[model samples]
Target: MRPQTTLRRLAEMKAARDPIVMVTAYDYPTARIAERAEVDMVLVGDSGAQVVLGHDSTVSVTVDEMLVLAAAVRRGVRSAFVVCDVPFGSTEVSDEQAVATAVRFVKGAGADAVKLEGGGAQRLSRIRAIVAAGIPVVGHVGLTPQTAVALGGMRAQGRTTESADRFVREALAVQEAGASAIVIEAVPAEVVDVVLPQLHVPVIGIGAGPADGQVLVLHDLLGITEGKTAVFVKRFAAVGDAMLAGVTAYAAEVRSGAFPAAEHGYPASADAIAAAAAAAAAAAALEPGQIAD
Candidate 1:
């Protein structure tokens, strides 16, 4: 078994200019695959709302649902760091509420760290409280999905001078608020370049260009998600097509009665068949007239 990845190791990797790799995973199989692939981190992201649970948006998922997904991922991960996303409402109530939610992920789901979206005042409070409670926190900024509506839809941030400045401010504030790492999503690469030097902690990017590391949705990268994906997603394997082809072939075989052939069936002894036939014949013969002795 591989040793667990620690916060110190992650920091060292960032210092050494080694790019970290992170992927989203919602369940055991995906988590196991991520571990086997030797990715640096596995995030049980709220994006699972769309990818796994078929929810329309991340906000629709609840803390209990996230806990279920996080725990399953935790069971399959051996070496990679496992970070669970605190869902939309999980941390919005108050710092105390945030600590409670983070505690559940650590105690119930075995999460190595918890990720909370946004870098507003409330968000920083949550990050600080969770960290004070002895649980590591990963801060998220730049086009937070939970409040995408307020951000004027699911679009890239930092396009304008004002927005770019705010983006940089939020990123730095999140790092100062006790986050061990930060994830920036859907922001311009140039803005991230400007903000990178100001940050001492590892910065993982999604649509936000190169940082200390990068993360992409597992389904998006593996070609399992149907239809359009974000610009940052690059399909590495057509797993969806392969799955469809496999099922289609199995269906065709079933229709043609090509499955369960002689080799697929269990062998039966001729003597046992004969004995069974004899018993059936005797039973039939005596049924109408008398009970068998």
Candidate 2:
């Protein structure tokens, strides 16, 4: 087996200019795929609210829901560093609440680190609290889905001058608060480039362009999600089409009675067949009102 990826290894990769690969995985199968693909990080992202659980937004996902997903991903991963998203409301109330939430992910889900969205003052305090509690943290800045409504919807951040300045400040604050790594999403590449020189930790870009690493939702990359996706998402495989085709073929076969053909079944011994025949005969001989022995 390959050696498990560690924070030290990730740091080395950043120093060596090796792009860290991360993917969000919600369950065992997806996590197993990520492990087999040799990804550097596996995120049990709150995006599971929309991707897996059919919720409309990330905020709807609770800490308990995230924990279940994180634990499942943990069971399927052995090599990649696993980070669980501390869902909205879990950490927003108070620093103590944030620490408790982080503890749950570490103790219950085996998360190597917990990721928190936003880099505002409260968020920085929460990051500090979680880190002080002995849990590593990955900070998220730019277009945080948890508070998209407040940011004027899920759109690209750092596009305006003021927005760009805020983005830079937040990203730096998050790093200063002791985040082991950071994820920058939906920000202009130019903005990210300016901050790259300043951030010492690994910076994983989603829609923010190249940095120390990149991450994408597994479903998005695998073509499992329908309709339009974000501009940054690039589908690497048509797994959804393949799945549909397989299921369509099965349904057609089932409807036409083409499935469960003679060769599809197990063969019984001659003695077993004879015993079944005798049992049928005995049943047929039973009186209408009598029970068989």
Candidate 3:
């Protein structure tokens, strides 16, 4: 109902009636489209590692690469709060190192905020430190791709009573650590159902539903892959299919010498064209001495 600050607006939307609609957009064009469509948040997610770089998981992306995409997304997005992910291995060192990496999103890539995995684990101190350094933090809880190796492969989390309770506690810990929002991913629906009302900060869900907000990997939503779409994702348009069809048609036309007809080329009055060409040649041949000084 009121004018919203970038990430703070997530808090407002959570407070108000409408649930925030967020999405992951790794590049400039996708960011521009999402911003124009009035998405509340746009994340330059390292899921680009999977979709763009052809990595099997998000593990291969680096902070520097994410920063590059984040800066480009920042330049493209005008309205939505743009959040960038801190990639795998970027924060393994220390708090100061985390703050330094976070600074690249601000000073280098121009992101409004940064998202990182873990809440009370190795990431808690770093989350606080980054916030203390005046950087907004988005805490990622429940399931983190950066820990794919440790997680023993991709699987849904919080099936057990203890794991569910731990997930809720970690969500609170992240909120306590000064995260403006928490990205709730790959957790049980019931767990999210309970935590959503309890969290003071906004919750952006991936697999979890009807949270304070929701986020989907853009590639999944765009139908960019013929392989598989995540269960939680919905395809809003068939952009990938249409683009491939269009490209294939163009290639066929080029191969068959059916494109570029005369009508598609230079169409001008012969006398005017001759005059223009002559004038262009005369201008090119002229020297300082031949000019009217």
Candidate 4:
């Protein structure tokens, strides 16, 4: 089944019991290619600040930077829903300020929706304001990276009964406040499982698997990012290994002078050779005093 209208397709996928597969995409080529390859959603994630520009975390990504990538991804993607993050500190402003900033992602960046970190903490009124303004929102919860300093590293959330209940409450509130979807990240599968049955909107998982669908960091899945994937993250492709093999082969051929074989070498051209000899004579074998002798 084709997941076309981001929300429509997400709902359809949920009904079909097919897990949605969303991936982070920062630019046009990746977005268009992913949409053509038929992925459900293209997330212009602020992670670009890390993966592309070598930032420390999503926090360091500016709203301007996110919009730049979002627009690029928007131009590339068609059919699948394109969502952009509000980036850090953009939504913590007034309700009017939040909507105004989110509008930039849609109008300036061509995103279909905006995603904001944190569900229950500080400014849920802003989420409602944006949705009320007719912009779709994808709520993020359970280990929001925008709050990483407070969250304290990559730890599983909702481990305790109270925390679990809080996670559920936040998820439900976000959905009720009109989030088209929710991204459960870096949380236990149990947290995902508990929420899946409870929410009407589709649950797109990152570290959470087999929920309504799943999402991943594009670089990690493609093995372009150098590191081991988490236990929760599954590998559909070994892009890193494949890339290594490809580069290794190319390097060896180049070093051994085995590359640029007969076919790759320039075809012998009599005109080209004659032109080169004329250039060589002009450059070398000069009569030292010919100009004034």
Best by TM-score: 2
Put the candidates in TM-score order, highest first: 2, 1, 3, 4
- Model 1 residue 94 lDDT? 91
Superior candidate under lDDT, 1 versus 2: 2
lDDT of 3 at 227: 86
Candidate ordering by lDDT (highest first)? 2, 1, 3, 4
Better of 1 and 4 by TM-score: 1
Tell me how far the alpha carbon of residue 6 in candidate 4 is from the true structure, in angstroms, after superposition.
3.8
Residue-pair clashes per prediction, in order, are: 0, 0, 0, 1
lDDT tens digits, residue span 1-293, model 3: 22434665666678885788888887888888888788888889999988877877787888777877888788888778888898877887999889999998889998889898986667889899999999999999888888856655566777888778888899998988889999988897887888777788888888977787789988888888668776777898898999999999999988999896677897789999999998888877888668622
Instruction: State the TM-score for model 1.
Output: 0.93
Best model per lDDT: 2
CA lDDT for candidate 1: 0.93
Per-residue lDDT, model 3, residue 274, is 95
lDDT of 2: 0.95
Q: Write the per-residue lDDT of candidate 4 for residues 140-181, one digit (tens) a residue.
A: 888788886676776767887876887788888888888999
lDDT, each prediction = 0.93, 0.95, 0.83, 0.82
* Candidate 1 local lDDT, 247-292, one digit each (tens): 9999999999998689988888999999999989999888577887
Pairs with backbone N, CA or C atoms under 3 Å apart (clashes), candidate 4:
20-213
TM-scores for every predicted model: 0.93, 0.96, 0.88, 0.87
Off by over 4 Å in 3: 1-4, 268-293
Residue-level lDDT tens digits of model 2 in 81-148: 99999888988889999999999999999999999999889999999999999999999999999999
Return the TM-score for candidate 2, rounded to 2 decimals.
0.96
